[model samples]
Target chain A: MPPEPDNIPDAGQAEEIAELVAKTPDTLPLKRPATPVFVPATLPDEPVEAPENGAALENPPVERPISVPQAESVPSQAVSVVAPVAPEPVSPPAVEFSPPPHQTFRASLTLELRCATPDASIRYALGAADVGEDGTLYDPAAKILLTQSTGIAARAWVNGESGPLALAHFEISQPQWEKKEPLDQSDATPHEISDQRALEGPWKLAAASVRGKLHAHRGGWREDAFAHDLAPAADGTYAIVVVSDGAGSAPLSRVGSNLLCRETLAHLRDALTQSAPLSTDAQELRERDLPLLRVVLVEAARHALQKLNEEAAKRARPLSDFASTLLILVRREWNGQQLCAALQAGDGAIALWNDDNTLTLLGMADHGENSGETRFITTVGMEAELPSRVRFSIRPNLHAVAAMTDGVADDYFPEATRLNQLFGAVLPLVENGDAPGAALLRWIQYEKKGSSDDRALTLCWRDDAAPQPETVTEETSDGHA
Target chain B: MTSQLISWKVRDLMTFPFLSQLGITFALSAAAMSDIPPPETAATEVAAPENSSSDGGAPELDASMRRLPVYLVLDCSGSMTGEPIEAVRQGMKTLLSELKSDPQALETVWMSVITFDSGANQVMPLTELLMVKEPSFEARGTTALGAALRLLLDQINQEVRKTTSTQKGDWKPLIFLMTDGEPTDQWEDAADAVKAARVGNFIACAAGSQANEATLKRMTDVVVRLNDLQPDALKQFFKWVSASVATTSMNIAKSDAPVGLPALPPEIVIVP
Candidate 1:
């Protein structure tokens, strides 16, 4: 007589197979092709209710167990059925069953699990699997097949750390099984990736400026100013950039700032013409010609001040009404080396980007007795000491240099720390083919915490410079006057 | 006789509150709010929003909104018993009313009121201008200017967040100190402490002929003298204070550099 179909131990057989699959190590050979299991279509469509004893069964089923070798050789679609009889004295009388070979019902299921975080790793009873970079995980025939009444437990490690264990109960009435939605859906995207190639290359100069929100809100004019003149040498070896900011207190500071930019560029042009012969030797330029550069910086300020005074006089306004600040950067090619000199007055800052992607703040803002207060180029004592304020240095692998007014300075150097991290987000885009000035203008305008000042920024870089190894060097300077 | 005289002056000033109100109304109407383009909207032209983030990796726009902390340090001493005290109350009401009407001031200015007599008390903690209520004043004891300064210093340390390595802090505070007599307590030490803190701009106003101008000058470089305590003169002084505060609030929002204050009213002379 054939065994009764109701006595088939489907749950007990599945539990044993699940235990065997859980014990298999990840290093086990994959030579055993994935097996697709088939079970009777009459299995319960919902999770089986726990037995009355509340304890899980541990005894083997009445049917014999399949050996590991035999199990590996089983066809993917083959199904094994075992019936375990309860050893009770009052067992119900078994009903005779007639087996119909041609009418046997069978079904197969394929399960796929996905993690919400793309980087998540999932571990199941049948072993562990990692989600692809695209955040998907699929098992052709989950080594231990799951029937309609089977329960699955999985633990996920998001970003390499384990999270809470997840328990899911399966219910399927068809041959193929799938959940309504993905198991996990991540909301976060990967860190921003830029198409570096799209950015224009071999940039020589970038500049941008914007009116502050406060200024806009109050209907005040943009008093801050910035200007840059990048004059690449005929030999493609040197350049000169000049930037300036007008005083916020001065009624005609915008004009003053514009004049300063023009005058400084003219002065620099004259100095470059005068020192054309000394540019050939790097040592001579650094040692003997450094004084000349300093004098040039002072003369530039004086000329700018004289022009501003003329304008103020024309308007019958006090020269103080046109007060402003100035910054000048000169890069000279000497014997295959780059020498840089910087001059600044009033409130603003300068930064140098090295080949290694590190930024060095050259000079801090010239703050006055208070935080918002600062000395102006046209102030009573500043013109006299302009030359001494010039800072000089010899940078071997300099990639770029940036200058900004107090509006930008307040955001970048709100405190004493020199190189704010916010600027790091900007450095990569300087060389990007996009208009560096326009990019910088947007960056400077980013709403800052306490500052709402007219912002101005100018950047100069060499695209041909080779990238340097990562070596962070902090160069401190007495930024306060 | 002195007490009788004080009572009469107080009654005279209280009878006409419209005068101060009219002055503030005229000042606010004459001034215009600025109309410059905002920086953030302009920034989008260069870099896409997705590519930009603050120093932190989080994709958040930098916020430009900030609070301008203002402190009104008043002298509620015996010298200000009558008309002077009454004028102060009217001045405060007018100031608060005008500021509340100004959208810019309402958005940025945070105010606190500190009154000093035998002791100093913070009648109002730092609060938004729109939310502030005019404080009641009663003049009775000696002027304890030193104690007032000490109290101010403590309040500043507790109230203001100085800029830190990783965080932005409140703007430098604007302090207005109005007094009518010499300090009855030791105030130099407190003044020194205030100077050392260097956290805000302190403008001292010496009211009446008997006010100690020299002491006021020592406390702050920006000092003004009120020639008399007449209601009109006091009203003019308050008008100037309101204009100064309005201009300062507008200036910081518009410019990065420190701006010189608006000219003081003719009746209130700057102490050179």
Candidate 2:
């Protein structure tokens, strides 16, 4: 005899399956491919009541008479009556699903389950590895709605026997994204200025500034700026590399960073040529070049800050709106020694890598107690702090020197401890056969787990001309007043 | 001395049956009621809601990525019984739709809901965005905000992962708290504890005229005030919340700016 059908949902295929199974009372359900029966559009059907144990329901299991397509079986002239019998104490009942086991993850998905055995209690778990005692009882009246990717495991128990686990896995494919170009409402900065350049000089230079993944995700352009040029004076060739990272919160910081790097390099070149230097005695370098170089680097940084102020004034914006961190490095082989003068305001680092895998931090990264608290060059009175942040080093046999924004510094942060590993990562870029500039650009684009800020990296090292002749003569003996 | 004289006069007039029913005695009683300030401490400390049948925390999610834990602490007191409660239901629907459409939020954001009314309870635990079900809330009882704050502190400590030398932890949790009236429980201690924990970024909303903005100030520096209890204002609040959560989810893994929230609608004003 067929099981009692009073509690089965009156809507959808479940009701039709019950009557069809009643016709063949001796056979099991789900094994037979019972054709689906569709309800007429005109029936203002009475809704079934919810199960007594309401708290167990994760979803409202009540079935509403909704319209849908697909009529496979002959439209029944009227509802078929089913002869009822006491629920047979059968072993675990076999369960089947309407939609196949695999499904796609969306905002939400509705799933319907069918059981052929009589009086079987179906319980299910979602997103769980397996169903156990913690699974929710599946009330037949409700449909299972899945909102995210998950594994659904269901089982049915009849009398004392438990059925085998019925499992389904739904996966969400990568979403198709629409191409979006940033709107250039402001004339201050272009939407995209990501670029790379290779410079040939005493110092092999490779420089790149690229937008980060987070910015690209939201249609934002790169906010880092870098300018590297081999400044030539009468005495020697000086490789000046400047890198600036714009504040993410500042809308026009791209302009700020770009202007700072350009103006600082320009001013430093002019100041280096005019400052009666490079001709001073090498033994008295600290007394002569140190004091004069400090003024030159600080003045260049001040000039950059001044340009930002002028730009902010022209735009009728606050100076703070153009906040960025600036790092400047000037390297020259003067009198048989690699002489370097560097100044940093705000966060980021200027480091020199030695041949033995040791890295020396030329200028320190200014950081507060929290990771987010970073200094910017536009901070008021920042020029006053420049003299102290400036570092002068006259070392022998420098392997490589790198100037970077916080974007690169953050990957190896707690600056005190991570510089050695940073050079380890940076050391291999030049040997990649192509222009080291292009290689550096590709290197910065490499993905790190938590590093998604706009990156600006400028690496300068001695190429095949490492032992090149030091062509400097003591001439033009005028000294700065 | 003046209040004492008035009390004595009220007592003396109460002896006369005809005058006892007049405004003098009623006014005296009203004055006495007003004189007793709202209690700062509960006689018995309110306990965090235990994991009841429905008050279970987030179910196990099949995720290997770092989660962005977000908590919504709402006030469901007796005053929010009618239109206000219904508006909140609609707001949740709006918030869910907003978050689900946001690809970043849908990918990483995990959410939980805590409701305070006479006592605070976690209606839903930290569940993934896909598995998050909009909690059904009922309006009744006084605002036991202290219980809610303490419960939130406990829940965050229990659920949020911390980064160590070996593994990266979950991003700092984001909390959005909304209340429409003065708290009816001792909340100062809990507020102080929350302020000192530095465990999460908080956005406290003093959501109606009766809401104590001063009380919320102690809980967080980022406080927004709603001038009225209108449904439109509350709906805008929820929309702003959706935008903030979406923005945070995109930046949570990479950027290092202090939890930058999106701009609020005109209906809400920043509490300076």
A255-333: candidate 2 lDDT, tens digit per residue: 8989999999999878775656464464355445566777888899999899999999999999877789899998887
What would the per-residue lDDT of candidate 1 be over residues B1-272, giving only the tens digit for each residue? 01111111122235433323221111111001122123233223333212222221112322222467889999999888877787786677567646655545655577889999999999878865544545668888999999999999899888765544333455678888889888999999888778777767788999888898889877778899999987667777777777777777776532345446788778899889
Instruction: Please tell me the TM-score of chain B in candidate 1 relative to the true structure's chain B.
Output: 0.74
Q: What is the TM-score of chain B alone in each candidate?
A: 0.74, 0.76
Q: Which candidate's lDDT is highest? A: 2
Stretches of model 1 off by over 4 angstroms after superposition = A1-201, A232-237, A277-282, A310-316, A332-337, A414-422, A428-437, A464-481, B1-69, B77-94, B100-110, B124-146, B153-173, B179-240, B251-272
- Measured with C-alpha atoms, the lDDT of residue A178 in candidate 2 is 34
